[model samples]
Every structure is written in C-alpha cells, then in structure tokens.
Target: MKNRRLSNLKYEITKNKSTLLAIIFLTLIILISIFAFLIPMDPSATNTSNILKPPSASHIFGTDELGRDYFVRTIYGGRGSLIVGVLAMIISTSIGVAIGTISGYFGGWVDNLIMRSVDVISSIPWMILVTVISIFLKPGLQAIIIVIGLFSWMETARLVRAETLSIKEREYVLYANSIGETSWRIITRHIIPSVFPTIIIAATSSIAGAIMTESALSFLGLGIQPPTASWGNLLQNAQSNLQSSPYMAILPGILIVFTIYSFNKVGNVLRVYLEPKVAER
Candidate 1:
C-alpha cells in the first residue's frame, strides 16, 4: 500500500511541472540545510578585514557586516529556520487535532465551548500577540517556535473540527458507536484517519506560516538572536547595510520567499489531489 502511494505521488509530481519544481527546490533546500555542517566555513567566525565584501570566487554569497561568510551563514540560517517551521507545525497540528477531535466527536456544550475559545483566541491580532509574548521569553529558536505554534493552532483546530463534525456522522462512525466502541476508539480508529488529509493540508500551510512568522520575529530582533544565523536575523543584520551591501538582505529574503512559496504550491497541489470535489471546482 505504501509503495503504491509512493508511486502515485511520484506520478503526480512528474505530471505536474510546477509541483515537480517546487518539490525539487524544497528537497534541495532541506538537504543543503541538513548537511550544512559539513561545509568548512564557520557561519559565526568574523574577519574584520573581509567585512562587506562583494560576491567573489572565494565567497559565493559574499561577506556580511560582521565579516562572516554570508553563504555559510545563509545555509546555517536555513537549518535553524526550517527546524523552527517544521517543529512548530508538529506542535500546532497535534494541539489542533486533539482539541478538534474531542470537540467535534462530543458535540453539544463541548463543541460550543471549544469553538468559542477558538474564537476568543482568534480575535486578537496574532502577530502582535506573538510579538508581545516573545518579548517576555528569551530570544531563541525554541521560544519562537512555542510562540508561533501556540498562536497558530486555531485555524487548524477549526478546520479539523469541521471535518470531524461531518466525519463523525458518517455511517462507519455511526456503526462503530452502535457497536459500543468507546468514543476514544472511534476517534482514534475512524475519525482521525478520515481527517488525516485535512491535517496534511493544514500542516503544509502551518509550516509556511511558522517560517514566515519566525522570520518576522527575528527581523524585529525578538526571535533568534544575532550570531545564531537565522534567515530573519540575517536580513536584520543586512538592513543597516542595505545600500552598501544589498545582496546580504536580498539573499536571505529570496530564500524565505522561495521557501514559503514552495510550501504554498505544494499545499495547493495536495489539496487538489486529496479533495477531488474541490479540484472539480
């Protein structure tokens, strides 16, 4: 079954040129980030004499204001950025699925209570809320991830809750309930599987949002601190030298844009493939 699924995925990618390119870019970026440590240049090491040099044979992406290798720093930054995005997605998705499943499966006051809470939380401007919360926490990867993950789960929760509401009323779920299967078992065995595709679609969007949020936070100096090599902080560092060394800002900005764009593309493709009725629209 897994092999067949994998084969179908490959077929889909091959048939869609845009998705194929997006996947390739995403894969290359992920691989490069994972193996970044293998490269010899130290992202944090500074050379006062080499500061703000333009791209050259020795430094493909040039040097930053701190005289650190911009290429190496950007690579390392991707590692940190992608880590925060992926981990935060996992945290948000877990919270969303659990709460959504409980609220939907139980219905009545449980649903109303959960939905109202989601609404209350969603009313606040999340970026402002995340920024205010981040100010209290120490600036680092984990702090940024936690802030983004917590604030970002509401949408996913709502999506899952809607899906779960419809799924719980289905014949199979009704059959399970009639057979005296525990609510927990019905949710775990039937509802979750039914909602998994929705979760996947939400997860892809969550990852993109998380990465963009982290970048924004770091740009404001509230996220990963300097010398840590996050893409956001890299852009922050380059902001002062925008005229003298625009490449410094442009490089990381391009990376963040492309990464987010690629994720969005992949999500769209997945939505089309997974939800056939929507595709027909």
Candidate 2:
C-alpha cells in the first residue's frame, strides 16, 4: 500500500499536461541534436545547381542561396541554439540561486550588496551589453552563451531570493535552527528544496528568452559566425532575396516561431502547476 501510494504521487508529478509537452518538445530538440551529427547531408555543402530551390524530395526544407540543404542546416543550427540556451540557463541559474539563497537567508549587509549589484546589472540594455562583449570577445557560440548567462541572471536571482526569504521564515526552518543544525545543513535540507520548484519553472521559461536573444544576435551578425548555421543566420540570408525566394527566409522564421511557442506553452503550464493559489478573504 505504501509503495502504491508513492507510485501514485510520482505519477501525479509526471502526468501534468505541461510536463508532458515539455518532455515531448525537449525530446524532439534532443533528436534534432543527434540528427545533426548523424545525418548525411553536409550542412556547408553548396550545390549551385540547386540554389534557392523550394522544398522537394531531395532537399526536404529546400536549399538556400549557397545551395545548402535547409533541412540539414535547420537541424544542425538547432543543435547550437539548444546547446547555448541550455548552457546559459545552467550558468545563470547556478549563480542566481546561490547568490539569492545567501542574500535572502543572511539579510542585512549581504542582501543589500547583492541586490544593489543586481540592480546595476539590470539597468543596462542586455542586447547592447552582449553586442559590446561580442565585439571584445570573438563572436561564437561560447561568447553568446556567456554574455546571455551573465546578463540574464538578475531575474532568476530576484525570483529565487523572494522564494528563499519566504521559506527561511517558516517554522520548520526555525525548528531546525533550534535543534542546532548547521547553517549550511538547514539551508540545503530546507530552504533549497522548498525554493527548487520555482527555480525549475523559471529555468524552463528562461530557455525561450535565451533562444530569442541568440537569434537576435545572430541576425545582427554578432552571433554564430559563418560556416555555422542558426535560425537567425538563416533569416539574415533571406533578407536580400526575400522577394524572389521568400521560402528561404520563411521556413527558418516559422521554425523559430514554433519553437518559441512550444516553450511558452510548456512554461505556462509549469507555472500554473507549481505556483500556489491564494485564497480570497
């Protein structure tokens, strides 16, 4: 009976529509990443013969100006985009959660210093900051990831700090402190676990934002240098020949829109499930 109850609880956590959609989309992205390495098509191969070709059996998503297969490029491009997004999320969330947890739990001077630093960073325009950094550093996947990760953490820090403050004030936390538990032990066992659900939901939502930021940077020629493909770079190519071969641009744009939409749907679902509903007085 106890085992059955545990299994049911696990099923409840996994069975939500948002969780399912997130899993499916994540799986699809992963498959695309693997396909990038396994697929036969040379993403950089140019077939002048098939230049600007529309979607056909031979070239699934058709060929671009350089006669490269759109389908293959899209898959390959997705690999880079997903990698940057995931890595950026990991970096930002780790830094944010640590700082937020410490600041909220300690309060006083520590909270003021961290919050003031966050405010300074938050005041700048993220895109411009990224662009400036990209200029100083080489423009590539790593550069974009670092830039986005650094700038994006403020929001996560603020969110985590708020959640941590609430959790730290709980009677359970006080009881653990009364029992002479070490600060680190109390924080890890109580505060972090309580705030983790919010962190997860926030992280999932941040991916969509990261993708858009990367796309914008790539579109501006400051992201993912040539010989590499991204949705943004693909769209950049489409700008010149938009009138003649709109498909060249439209396909990648469509994919970007769909990817962002999928992420938003999943994020919304998770937010609803994880957040507590307030009772009316």
Candidate 3:
C-alpha cells in the first residue's frame, strides 16, 4: 500500500508540470531560507547613503528606505514567513486533529456541541476575529503566529471530523471496539492513521493560509514589527515607496503571491493524488 501510494505521488509529480515546478520552487526557497544566516550581510543593517537605490549590479532588487541590502533582507524575510507558516501549521494541526477526533469518534451530544461551536466560530468573519485577538496581544512573530494558528484550525477540524466519522465506522474500528480496545487506542492506531492523508493535505493548505494571514496583519501594522524582516513587513515597509521605488513593493508582492501559489498548487496536487474521488472531479 505504501509503495502504491508512493507510485501514485510520483506519477502525479511526473504528470503535472505546474506541480513539479511548484515543488521545485518550494524546495529551493526552503533551502534558501534555511541557510540565509550563512550570508554575511545583516538584513537589518542600514546605510543612509544607499537608501532607496534602484536595482543595479551591486544592489539587486534595489535598496529599501533604510538602505539595507534588499536581496539579503528579502532572503531573511522568506525565512520569517516560512517559519510562521510551518509553526502555525503545526499548532493548528495539533489542535484540529485532537478536537476533530474527539468530536467524531464520540458522537451524540459531544459531536453536536463541538460542531455547533465550530459553526458559530466559522460564521464570524475570520479576519475580524484574528485582528481583534492580535490587537490584544503584544505584536511580534510569536504573537502573530499564535493568533493565526488558533483561528485557522476550524477548517482543518471540520475536514478531520468528517474523515474520522467515516473511519470510525470501518470494520477494523468495529473489530477493535469489539475486542475491548480502549477508545484512545482505537483512535490513535486506526482512526488517526486513516485520516492522516487528509491532515497532510489540510496542513499544506494551512501553511499558505497562515502566510497570507501574517502578511495581511503585518501590512496593517499589527504583525512582525520593524527590525525583523518578514515578507509581509517587507511589503508593509514598501507601501510608502510604491511610486518612488516600485520594485520595493513589487518584489515582496511577487514573493508573497508566488509562494502562496506554489503552496496551494502542491496542496491541490496532493489532494488529487491522495483522494482518488477528488481526482475524478
């Protein structure tokens, strides 16, 4: 089964040019972000003499208002953005899987209560909730990540709950229950493994969502403050220079769009590959 799944994934990668390119881009960017510290230039270091310089041989992507190395700053920004995405995804996935599993495996009042709460939360505009919560917390990468992760779990929870509902009804689950296995054991062993594919796809998409959310918050001045370069804050810093130094804004905008697009592309491909019914669509 593992081999067949791997073969399917390999086939999907080989068949879809966009997916392949997206995977390659994501891989390259991740590597760049990881090794960004090795670069000698300090992203935050400023030179008043070099401020707002246009793209040239020496300063690719041009200098920002602070006269920092745009190239280095952008690389560091990618590191921050990717970190927020990954950490937020982990937080959301852990919360979502736990709540979803409990809600679905133990149906009746528990399911109804949890589903109603999810519905209530989902009914509110997501951005409003996140923004309000963000305002209360001290602004920084950690605060932004926590806000995004906490609010971002609803969709994942719903997806997992649906998967759990189906998986718990399977014969293996029934057999486990009949054998007097603990509910926790059954859920951990059979249900979680069965629903894990869904979690992977959801988590992939969650990273993109988290990144976009962070960008929006930062643009609004409620996220990653100055001195720390995130793609979001890079764009935020560029807002005043749009007319004078369009590349300042354009570069970060391009990064945000392309990074989110690549993540979404990968997520969609995984969904189609892992869930054959989705592929049929």
Candidate 4:
C-alpha cells in the first residue's frame, strides 16, 4: 500500500547515520531542556557568600560573580537557547517551505516575485538587521528569536525552492498532473513529500546558525537581558573578569562550542546520507 511505501522510506531515512546523529543531538538537547525545569537550584538566586567559589562538592560548576551556581544557570540558560532555536526554526522553516512550495510549484511570475523578494532580503547582513531590530525592541529571548527567524529564512527558502522545482519535474509528478490531479493535491501529496528530506536537512543546519546568532546578539549586550542566563550573556558578563576568572567565560564558551559542534556533526551526517550518490555507493 501507499502507506507501507511511505513508512519504508521513513525507515530508510532514519536508519541513515546522519539522521541517527541528528536524532541523538536533538534528543539530548530536548532532555536537557526538560531537566532544566526539574532541577532544584534557583537560576537567578544570588548568594554573595558563595560568589566566585570554584567548582566544588556543593556547587559543581561553581558560582558566578553574583554567587549563582553556574550549573543551575547553565541548565536554565539552555532552556532559553533551545526554546528560541526551536521557535525560530519553526518560523523560518514554515515560511521558507510555504514560499518555496508556492514559487516552485506554480513557477512563472510567482517564482520570479518570490525569488526576487528573497534576494532582496538575503542581501542584507543578518547581524546588522538583528542589531537594528534589537535596538528598537526590548532585549529579550523572544525578540532575539524573532529577529533571527526573520532573517534566517532566506537560505531555507532558496534551498526548499530548488528542491521543489526538481520534485515538480519528476516523472511521478508529471504522471499525476496528466491524470488530472488537482494542483493542490499534487503539490501537497507529492511535491511536498519529495522535497521534505531537503527541508529537514536545511532546518537541522540552520539551528547551529541560529544558536550562534543568539550568542552574538547576547555578547553585544543587545541579546537576552541580565538574569536571563544565555550563554552569550554569560560571556558578556565574564568579559570584564576574563583575566582574573577565566573559568567564568570558558564554561559557557565551551558549551556553545560543543552544542554547535554537535549540531554540525549531525547535519553533515544527514547531508551525506541523504545524497543519492551516497545511497548508490
């Protein structure tokens, strides 16, 4: 049956090394996000007595300048980062997939208009755009997510559009069209499914970019406000004490590096597995 074929395709995709890695990375992050909520330590609690204490039996990651446990803050910080990343990805991918689907499937003036708009948006420097937006809006998690999501969609749009165009030209697509299937039906049932693998790949890749953007925004003091505990904001606070307390900056920096690296590794694996030549080989 059609359902069985679709299930098999999904199994093959999931069996891919890249897909497995991505799944693991995403799963770990999700679990961490959940754990942040369950932990006992107060992310914002400040105890001057415990300030700058090195990692010890009581406070594993040590306390910050404000005497808040770094471990607790890091976990709480992951909440914001992961939430923003997920929200931004949802927004970017939705907009990208929709615009790309419409443009590629319909083509003609629609394609020209969509692509031209994308080019115009893409020409702007993302960081500058984010900076401008941050200046006007309150510096917070939601604002950063919105700004990054808005600017990051161009790449996804371009990638999805290209995939859609190719899928629309496939023999199965042509056969469906020849059989007088409705345009919407063909696009939804056939075109979208065909391009989904590419979209998944692009979305995974974009998460790393989003995390970095959020960090940059936080580092510039235009990102998440004080007491929010983003990795970027943590680094911003540590800049003044980097010489005396290098551990302050190093901890968050290492987390950001590891997080981005994990996502990139997963994305690379997915890319390789999804390629036709790799499958052929």
Question: Model 2 TM-score?
Answer: 0.87
Error of 2 at 73 (Å): 0.7
Cα RMSD of all models vs. native, in order, equals 2.1, 3.7, 1.6, 3.8
Q: Model 4 Cα displacement at 233 (Å)?
A: 0.9
Off by over 4 Å in 4: 1-26, 269-281
Tens-digit lDDT string for candidate 4 (202-271): 7876787788888888989888888898888888988887776788888888878878777766655555
Q: Give each model a TM-score.
A: 0.94, 0.87, 0.95, 0.86
User: lDDT (0-100) at residue 194 of candidate 4?
Assistant: 79
Model 4: colliding residue pairs:
18-269, 18-270
175 Cα displacement, candidate 2 (Å): 1.7
Cα lDDT tens digits for candidate 3, 1-281: 55665667787789878789999999999999999999988898999999999999989878999899999998999999999999999999999999999999999999999999999988999778866886688889999899888888999999999999999999999999999999999989999999887898889899999999888888888889889999889998988988999888888788899899999888877766676555532
How displaced is residue 56 in candidate 3, in Å? 0.8
- Model 2 over residues 54-127: C-alpha lDDT tens digits? 88999877888889888889888888888878888898888888888998999999999999999998998877
Pairs with steric clashes in candidate 2: none
| Distance from true location, Cα of 263 in model 4, Å | 1.7
Distance (Å) between predicted and true CA of 9, model 4? 12
TM-score between candidate 4 and the true structure: 0.86
Model 4 local distance difference test score: 0.80
